[model samples]
Target: MQLGIDQDQADANSRITAIRAAVLLTRSMELWRRERLDPETVLINLAVIAITSERLMRGGLDPKHNSLDVYLPLEKLQGCNVASIAAATGLNRETVRRRVKSLTSAGSLIRTASGDLALPPDKVQERSAQELVRRQLEALVRFANESLRDGVLMLSDEKG
Candidate 1:
């Protein structure tokens, strides 16, 4: 006896498998970065604040229409409090407080008027952040183009 599979169904399954692998690879990179930043995890947590604060400020704005100049105003951005960060990251409140204090001292994070934590506007434009973003974008583009060429992903008819 032999099992039979249709070509269309097999193609769809291959695409799904490829996407799942890509997702795992992306998450592994994030975990690796977190581990490489510090064994204590303080730097990684601080980095999360620096990255997420920008996204939170951007809110429902289209990327093309959003300007860093408009969103980089530290005062205009909402800060993430220790409790919220703790809840989001699954870290204890004390750990969050301690790490946040260290980050503040290191100039990576600042204390807001409401005693919440935020990334400094200057920090947002730091060379390290810029380089990291550049490298990540390149990696993503390479992955996407390779996937398209391999027929594991499809692009719609829309062009930007």
Candidate 2:
């Protein structure tokens, strides 16, 4: 059986998805800045990692299965160089370098032999990752429960 959605429902879903993406991105930036104490540095670091991750994923690397070795390969992931990151983020090369240096010193980033930066899983703090994941899951669950309570979705056992 195929599930179908009306045009209006599809449009609403698209709008909701866009809004959620915007909110999530803003909140993620805020959280990173609060944790790092520097918005520029946090943003640059995030950009570097994000660019690197996307490049690797596009190259057929499955992050969920390959671990850090795949994402932060020693051979350098294409399009993840400091220059590309600086260009994509519209940040000065020097500023990107400075933030990359800081992140490297903090052990949250690693530089490959070719000078590409990446966020290896080993460099990440497990507790911090766990906490962030927990917070995100809680937020999603709370949102779903609130929607259910407000009659946006009916419980499985509820009579129509």
Candidate 3:
């Protein structure tokens, strides 16, 4: 097998990325399990967070509110619905609905008048959540460094 770095090695990149992603997901599940969070619930929460992040990247958000200490205002978020979450995550709609209901009741997630769901500011501000983000980020950084060293991607040589 060709182990040396190849810049055009799309297959190698896919395999490496999948491995790194699984490690992150497993570590996250372990942390969530210790917190008594169901894996499915955690997965659903991740989908919601991912959707919110996409909006942030698109700009027009007031950054002050979208911090670890606070979440974007419901009105300022496109948010996510159970059906949408299920669609995006490829999870069963009923499963997403059940978890969303439970999370809302437990105050882990907030529900808006538009039937959209979001992670609450209080949840984001939790010490455990902060710790989780830190550890996960560290793992991601390692993955990035490894990928770069393996030539999975690179900084543009050309000036933009």
Candidate 4:
């Protein structure tokens, strides 16, 4: 009986976390769309942006390359290529390719000579972009607080 109750609590916690996460993601997407950062499309554009940027922090954090004001030079960013993006996103390669092209043309992504893709440094440095990021961070903090209040997040995850 006790074991069953423990399992039920675990399952409830997982479901609550998922519910909070979905709401947070929806809010973030709303902010992203309102910013008009990728007017050409939606999920694919966001997916490509996130997938291509994995190189910067995948191994370790390099302050020089990862900071908003200090992104790697175009030649050295080594962002993911189409194949990797498609693999990560599980989208058809052709669809990923088309979206990447569109995003690149829209100035949301930068395709380099090596066929790697990354964001233009100026894209993040702009005041509006930074503001959008700040709002998203605020939403994340709210999500954490809500989760803790709901008992979805472990107390160990809380901080002073």
Candidate 5:
């Protein structure tokens, strides 16, 4: 009788452990879903950065003119030559120099020279916006593929 009771207790404990693990796994998935950033917002920011860098490279605007016309309304412009970009974009003289360096480092913008920092035109939209959209979609496809693969593996494990 004691042996039977011992086996039952062990079975119950095993079941409890499995339930806790399953709950943890579910919570992790929920967190990942909740933390996903909006892709459209990310794409817009990237577009602004790319366009600004392209402008600087092609010399559409002088780096010593106005920086705010370019950098202020954009996201993530650090690690660049701000005085130069400020001259072009019309951005704040002080902020331009400081933020430009940081933006360039973060890949949001690029500098054409040590002194000039206008964005290149190609980065913005030279021919058609469709091309830009296509490139962005391609990147999203790759991201989705990786996520789907992980989801499938998780689903299979749960069933087995």
Candidate 6:
């Protein structure tokens, strides 16, 4: 039986991409679960999106406002943990706390604690560029740690 082109493509390209994607997705979920990311964390991600979009717009390009960005900074900043959420979203502390709480109760956010909130996994996945940037940061941190370790080893070798 001859399957459709999608089936054929799935059978072929899927082998490579699917496993990688699944593994990456699992890792992301694990991070989210273990870290219990707050609304501020999600807001930080939105801020990055906003900054990127602003840069794009300034570079002679048309950039659309991310819905999350618009909501967090403009509307949803009131229900968060004030200082922390404000620091994350660049909004006023009182505003962030209020808005974050409302969003959390409405299921627009994943509320881990009175002081913490995060965008749902679906929303986070929808904004996968943020995740990619985070992965890049993780890689950089790992590289830096390795370099520091190697430097220490070299120093010890020289001493001994």
- Largest lDDT belongs to which candidate? 3
The best-first sequence of candidates by TM-score reads 3, 4, 1, 2, 6, 5
- For model 2, residues 1-160, the per-residue Cα lDDT tens digits are 2222344544556656455557766666666665655777766766766786675667686546464222344454554666877887898989887777777898777776666777665644356655665665665665555444444434454333
RMSD value for candidate 1? 7.7
**Per-residue lDDT over 68-108 for candidate 3, one digit per residue giving the tens place of the 0 to 100 score:** 77754667667688888998889999988888888889888
Candidate 4 lDDT over residue span 104-133, tens digit each: 888877867787777777876778777887
Output the worst ten-in-a-row residue range by lDDT, candidate 6: 151-160
Q: Residues 1-160, candidate 5: write the lDDT tens digits.
A: 1111234434545555455446554443443234342332233333445545564456554554343323332222233344444454555667655555555575545555443343443444333334444554555455434433333211232222
Best by TM-score: 3
Each prediction's Cα lDDT score? 0.61, 0.62, 0.76, 0.69, 0.43, 0.48
Query: Candidate 6 residues 19-46, lDDT tens each?
Result: 5546655554455544465645455445
Kindly give the number of clashing pairs for every candidate. Answer: 0, 0, 0, 0, 39, 16
lDDT order of candidates, top first = 3, 4, 2, 1, 6, 5
Higher-ranked by lDDT: 2 or 5:
2
Write down the lDDT that model 5 would get. 0.43
Candidate 4 minimal-lDDT segment of 10 residues: 1-10
Residue 40 local lDDT, model 4: 35
TM-score of 2: 0.59
Question: 4 or 6, which is superior by lDDT?
Answer: 4
Q: Model 5: residues >4 Å from true position, as ranges?
A: 1-81, 84-90, 113-115, 120-160
RMSD after Cα superposition, model 2: 6.4
- TM-score per candidate, chains pooled: 0.61, 0.59, 0.78, 0.74, 0.24, 0.29
